[model samples]
Target: MHPDGSIQAESNSSKADRALFNSSEARRARLLPSAEKKKRRMPRKGKGRREMAGSRHPLIEAVDPLAEIFYRPRTVTVMTVGLCLLAWFSDAFGLYGTKFSAENGVKRGLWALIGTFLAYSALYAPHTFMIRPHPIVWRIVHGVTILYMLFLVLVLFLDADQARHAFKYLYPDLGVALDERAYGNDCRVFTPENTSSRFANIMDTVLDEFVLAHLLGWVAKALIFRDWKILLFLSIGFELMELTFAHMLPNFNECWWDSWILDVLLCNNIGMLIGLFAIQRREKYGNEWVGVSSQPTILLKAKRLFLQFTPETVERYEWKMMSSPKRFIQCMTLAAACLACEVNAFFMKFVLWIPPRNMLNTYRLFVFFLMVIPAVNEYYYFVTKTGKEQVNKLGVFTWIFLSCTFLEFLIIFKFGRELFREPWPPLVKWSWMAAGASTTVALLIWTVSRRNKLKTQ
Candidate 1:
């Protein structure tokens, strides 16, 4: 009143309300779990975050800050209703009518089936070892892989002509006989003009376009495998495979220099080196990852954002095949499976009359490339990783891979029976037997050595 601002006294109700609120908050804090309470007490950034992450399993990747959006609950009810409504409006009304042939009807049905399967996959596909690049990508991988497996199974049921016709329906240009000889007919015998024509041979081999494909394919394999020993085994194993199958599939027949030098030493080795070099760079520098959102510069953030699909980390692997008999068998099985995959690709092409130039061939290879990443990762963990982090069962991707592998073999054996009827060279048979005996001897030696080492210990 006297032009002076005096402080007001505290209201009793307000004082009581403040005290009550503080007491309630204290109660809530006390009721929390010890871990939760500790987490809440920790600083939001730096050491606290590092501790939390360090406590988690290594297989669990860093969750994107935006990952909550992707975790929203999904249901098939809406999708199912939409499908029914579309079918009712279109099919029930006989919009297309009987103008659709039986073949057209079947094709449409197949397309619908494939679409449904893919939708299910996107919504419900099982997770594998790979979760980065978005789980949706791995879902798509699963969908495509299972579809490929079914395709292989379907091929087994059909005769060669039937399979050819069906495949042509999809690709249109495939059903023609391809010249299987990769190095060409000139490699059959050494002539003065032929064997000496190194320049022409290199040009021919390089120009075939498959050489480039092989180079890129090996690069991908190296990255997926991330192990030089495994890559070397596959490279040499495939060469021996080519030798064994050369009598039947002429494409495997190549000049000694071409097989060992051009294909192996040049294309495969170069690609693998490039891939391994990339891995080295990533391991050396990219081992530490700053959050994409945490980057100070826009350009750096954008670069990190773009590279989100790349591997979270690149760590080299040591298969240690000879560590023990069990491990040796496992490693050999894995390598053999890889070799089988390569054989399946070639065998399917030859049997189904799909030429190497066909888009289907390219697509098949691309599928294999995508699939093997998760497959190998899963298999590695299954065999090696132990205790709580161990994968007790084969993962979805690995199962799909094995299923397709064996299914393709069955298909080849069933449809290509006539090819097998041809007399295989006696040398090829004896050589394979010798290889089996050698592997057996090697396993026994390892077993004996391990036993002796245990006794000494």
Candidate 2:
């Protein structure tokens, strides 16, 4: 009986040991999956390390910032709203009565508030609507061009005095701001005796505000055409334009030296060379030549920030307008469009009584500069592409550009009826000049094509 009891006790101990072993095994089985999961989650070497680092560091993915900015656009939008609110409060209420007279303060405050809101709206409107930055700029540019067209259209319905009232509404001191200085003052006919005075006056004109405007205008033309020949043609054409319209617009009158030397040589020629040089440099160096974004340095970031004001893209334009008759026709159309734009610049100033230094004139110039970038791209596509692939319709910006040009002409006709009462003769002259210019351009293009073919032969 004692032997039996000893065997039973041993069996019981064995059973307890088995039970402990089973429980431990079950616990390990439950923990095994978790351990494996941790193993899988841990980052590995090489690619995995890079990915992990990128996920942790925002700057690592700075190359594609638009994507990141887009993903968390709500945060950006909220921040903009908060800052605008702060500005409004600070301007309107915080310093309203203390720093300025109540009426003046409130006026300034409202301007600040509204301006801030508009500016923010302009910046984020594209983001909210799911468009890219360059496209956003395109849209803004087209919008401004269209706005100007509509404004001019509105002005077309108003008489001269009513237009003056319109200007007064925008600026109360419009009359006082208007420069009543007559053009061609003290009309100095070219004489050898008065050569010194004439030279002095021409030199003075060379360095005046209009010189910068002329230079910039030529620069814009250079960027548009990217051809020295076409730039030369346009430069000569503008001098002809000034001569053509001088009888109607008194301001178009200029000395021979002023037109050929001061304008064509000093301003237009120099400006075109500078602009073309920039284009060449851009081509040689590529878009990332500055390496501003790639450097990941504070100085580079600041440089890139400043460069945002420059062209978003700079592509080398090889105009093959001489390739076909259709292309030649398109080029002539472009010349006409360019001439019309130049005419509009002068007429708008004359009609609106806006000086060179006026805010309105500056704003118009800025908007036009911005507008042409996209418009020219779209126009080039329309001109180059053929048949099924060609864009048959004008893009929004291009349409706006043409419309604005037409409206400017309409404005001049409507407002300057007295000034242009004898427009028939000038109109006839312009038509003849335009025909001659087109013929000259076509001949030049044909000559270039013939030379190219000969080289190929």
Question: In terms of lDDT, which candidate is strongest?
Answer: 1
Q: Which segments of candidate 1 are over 4 A away from where they belong?
A: 1-71, 74-99, 182-184, 187-198, 285-298
Decoy 1 TM-score against native: 0.79
lDDT of each: 0.72, 0.61
Residue 18 in model 1: shift from native, Å? 40
Report the lDDT tens digits of candidate 2 across residue range 215-268.
877777787778776678788888888878777677777777677877788788
Residue pairs with backbone overlap in model 2 = none
Query: Where does candidate 2 stray beyond 4 Å?
Result: 1-67, 70-72, 75-135, 176-198, 287-296, 304-309, 387-389, 423-457
- The TM-score leader among the candidates is 1
Clashing pairs in 1: none
- How well does each candidate superpose onto the true structure, as a TM-score? 0.79, 0.66
Worst 10 residues of 2 by lDDT: 1-10
Lowest lDDT 10-residue stretch of candidate 1: 1-10
lDDT of 2: 0.61
lDDT of 1 by residue, 1-457 (tens): 0000111223567445434422323323332346765656656797457544322222333344434344333545648775885595348678667567787878887887887788777766754445466656678789999899888877888888888888877878777767775565564333446564646656676687677778988888888888888889899999999898887787787888778888789888999999999888878753345555456799977886666667755667767766679987888888999899899888888888888777887888888888888888777867876554445677677888888889988988887987667787899899999989998998888889989999999
